[model samples]
Target: MNTTPISSRLHIAIFGRRNAGKSSLINALTNQEVALVSDVAGTTTDPVSKAMEILPIGPVVIIDTAGLDDTGELGELRVKKTYEVLNRTDLAILVIDGTIGLSEFEENVLKIIRDKNIPVIGVINKKDLSQYSEEDKRKWEEKLKLELIEVSALKKHGIETLKMMLIKKAPYDDRELSIVGDLIKPGDFVVLVIPIDKAAPKGRLILPQQQTIRDILDNDAMAIVTKEHELKETLQNLGKKPSLVITDSQAFLKVSADTPKDIPLTSFSILFARYKGDLEELVRGVKAIKKLKPGDKVLIAEGCTHHRQSDDIGKVKIPRWIRQIVGGDIQFDWSSGITFPDNLEEYSLIVHCGACMLNRREMMYRISYAKSKNIPIVNYGVLIAYVQGLMPRAIEMFPLAKMIYEEE
Candidate 1:
């Protein structure tokens, strides 16, 4: 459980005003000094995240954010950062000070949570102070239209009840989708084409490849892994057609050429696009590539930060391919991890990575964010397919996405 990726865990963010005991509540919840508790008003300047296995909730990433009502110039920046955490937050814990009662700042935060449509649990801390009563809880619950839980971080009272409420209210989606198992039956053979390049992690396959193999095994299917050069021979020696051929998007051209036309072909990034993002919407966004004009601004965003190889895909290959397709130069901007620009209107298109390191909710938030600004957004795999004139084949495994691409 400790080895679980932060992206795969449930993200529970704590939001409140200064000295609302947010840090103390986090410490009590995890039974550890996960957050620094201080008497100072703005000790938590940025979002501090900790990944742990909470009972009844399994694995979760608990985030402690800055106070919502921070004042002054620097405080405004801290407050801005707090709101940014909301984009990736799956569930929110809005902590209120029992002594001060609820304020407009807390209400404003609640409104944003409601607008985001994520589940939230209202917590009234400092119960040991006796400043708040049951009537106060009832009135606030009625006014906010949310369930309220009382807890004393200092005395640890009602902590168990808060945990129970968290278990009951935390979003639980039982329908866990598979990477490739749903598309293939038991005993079916699937071939994976991975390229061992400078960017490849030493002595190991990337996370997506490892996860896809695990999923195949879990479904009672067989997964044959090989490099791009060995893919042709591996397929020839199998003596049986594979149900699907999934390859790295960077090696799409070589893998597609080696595999038979009848066999369904896709990429790891494409699978993640469907699993973590909106495939149909991304496919629709690919059409915008053909409409690119000279001097247009394009933003390429990656979900993880890593040292760039000489021929990095995002920095080198993608730009070169787009220029060749457009027959002219275009301005390109880059961003990685959780630092997406707020002024998205400046770009004509936004190309994002597979987002295997990001949760489904965060990926959807990014896609929805781009859409709200009327900017077209495409994923790495879909963009590679479009540039290589294989968009239809790359998404063939996803029938609905393929149909949508064909129609466009």
Candidate 2:
């Protein structure tokens, strides 16, 4: 359970003003000192996350953020970070002090949560010291329009009820989506082409590759993993033709030539674009490449930060390819990890990574945010396929996406 990746767990965030027992509540919920507790107003200066298996809730990532009402310059920065956590939050716990009740700060936070369309449970902590009356609860219920759960985090009172509320209100489905399993039938063989370059981890495959193989096995299909150099040999030695050939985006050119054109070919990034984000929307976004101007700015966003190798795709190879395709000077900007620029109007196009390190909610949030701003957003795989003149072939297996691209 502890080995589960953070991206695979449900993200639950705790939000409130200072000294509202937010940290204490987390301790009580987990029944461990997972969070630092102190009497200081601004004890938790940054967001602290813990991935644990909660009974009834299964795997979950509980994030404890800074107080929403923090003051001073540093405190304001902390508050900003707190709000950013909402992007990936699957469920929220608005911890309000029972004695103080809901103030302007709490109301503002609630409004932001509602704006994000995140499911929430209003928690009135410190119930032992200041028990909230039924009338108080009714007023809050009417105003907030959400179910309220009263608890004393210090004494562990009502903790079980709070756990039950979390189980009931969690915004997740029991049926999980597949990466590529649903695309093939049982007993079919899928070949995975992974390029072991400098960007590749020293001793293991990346998350997307690992998850894809697991999904294939779960569907009772065979997965053949090989490096780009060995792909031809692997295919030639196979007793039967493979159902599909999926390659790393960087090795698409070589892999496409080596594999038979009759078989469907795609990249791991493209698969994640559909599983984690909107495939049709990304397919449409690829059109922006053809409309690029000399001075237009393109934003390349990555979900995780790592040391850039000499031939790094996002930093080196992608820019070179864009320049080659556009045939002129183009401005480029880069962002990695949770930090995304708010002023996106300057960028004519946004190209994002596969987002294997980010949860589905966070990936969708980035895509939807770009769409709301009228910005064209494409994924790394889709853009690579388009630039390589293989867009039609890359999406051949996904008929709807191919149709949309053709219509556009």
Candidate 3:
């Protein structure tokens, strides 16, 4: 049950007019009939997303959107919906009917894409049916202000070229995780407190934990895994002081108290916060916790699926802790996966999960969304630290971030 959210995967959007082989291109690239292909215009009114492992690109989410050339009032609505996809789209494949040169609709979409500064690959589809002379191909390239690649989705032509182009255009996103490894020296000991409580998944560790361990090992560092109860003994049994102590958000208070302040201490979620390049903003959101009063509605947002653990952090523990800190009843709202409530104004504060499954672009979009609405948004680690009165202690691990907080 990997159940990892599709939002975490690379988002590649295929945009073109209806019957321009948008769906065909997707089928050819993924080697599956993932999306319905039809000669009829506007076959896909809504965005259809399919997750697959593309060669040289690993995991990616292919987004097939409605044709831009659609007409009528309904078509206008569909076009509006397609534009919304641009905000989160990492790469864009502008599929055009090879016979029909770039049309007004496609030109309009390209203008918007260019305005947003989105990386795009102009794919002249249906090349099998429409043979273009070398001069014509060069002319199309000059007209579009982009190098056009010929593709025949129906016959599965030019797919390998497309894949190679994607690898070169938007190379693999290696920075999906943070650079926390650089903070430690080789052979240094790093203890990770993974609380095997109700929230722990059944078969495997969560993405953040797994990635952290991988990062440590990649840096030639030692990672010690333990539960909250083993903190005291684990620290004592170790030959020397561990370089860092990373804990689950739920056990932040106890772990922070147990671990010496001299040694750096933080949480898995905080590591992810920095990995996504928004630690300073997250630390700012923690200040909102103090402003929350009794009966304030707080949104606990998790980017993944439900955990089988009985005391689920989003459902059970966070609300309980907030209630105790507020000294009164507080309403809690839970949002998991790609869904986020349309009406964000109602919530007093938003505490997001580590967002291990979401890419940096989407995470930044979420942070910006909250900021645009003037709503405070914080992550699990920052909120947990505030509740435990260890905000400064946890943030001490980040030197530049510590200075920002102290100045604020």
The best candidate by lDDT is 2
Q: Could you give the candidate ranking by TM-score, starting with the highest? A: 1, 2, 3
lDDT of 1: 0.90
Give the clash count for model 3. 2
Per-residue lDDT value at 187 in model 1: 86
Better of 1 and 3 by TM-score: 1
Find the 10 residues in a row with the least total lDDT in model 2.
Answer: 169-178
Q: How many clashes does each candidate structure show, in the order listed?
A: 0, 0, 2
TM-scores for all candidates: the values are 0.97, 0.96, 0.86
* Candidate 1 clashing pairs, residues 3+ apart or interchain: none
Error of 3 at 277 (Å): 4.5
Candidate 3 — which residues are off by over 4 angstroms?
1-9, 45-58, 68-84, 131-140, 171-179, 292-297, 307-311, 323-332, 345-348
Residue 331 accuracy (lDDT) in model 3: 92
Poorest 10 consecutive residues of model 3 by lDDT? Answer: 1-10
- In candidate 2, stretches whose alpha carbon ends up further than 4 angstroms from where it belongs are 173-175
Candidate achieving higher lDDT, 1 or 3: 1
Model 1 misses residue 35 by how many Å?
0.7
lDDT of 1 by residue, 103-151 (tens): 7778888999989998999999988885777888899899888878888
Residue 93, model 1: Cα distance from true site in angstroms: 0.6
What's model 3's overall lDDT?
Answer: 0.82
lDDT of 3 by residue, 249-301 (tens): 88888898889878898888888898864899888777777788987899988
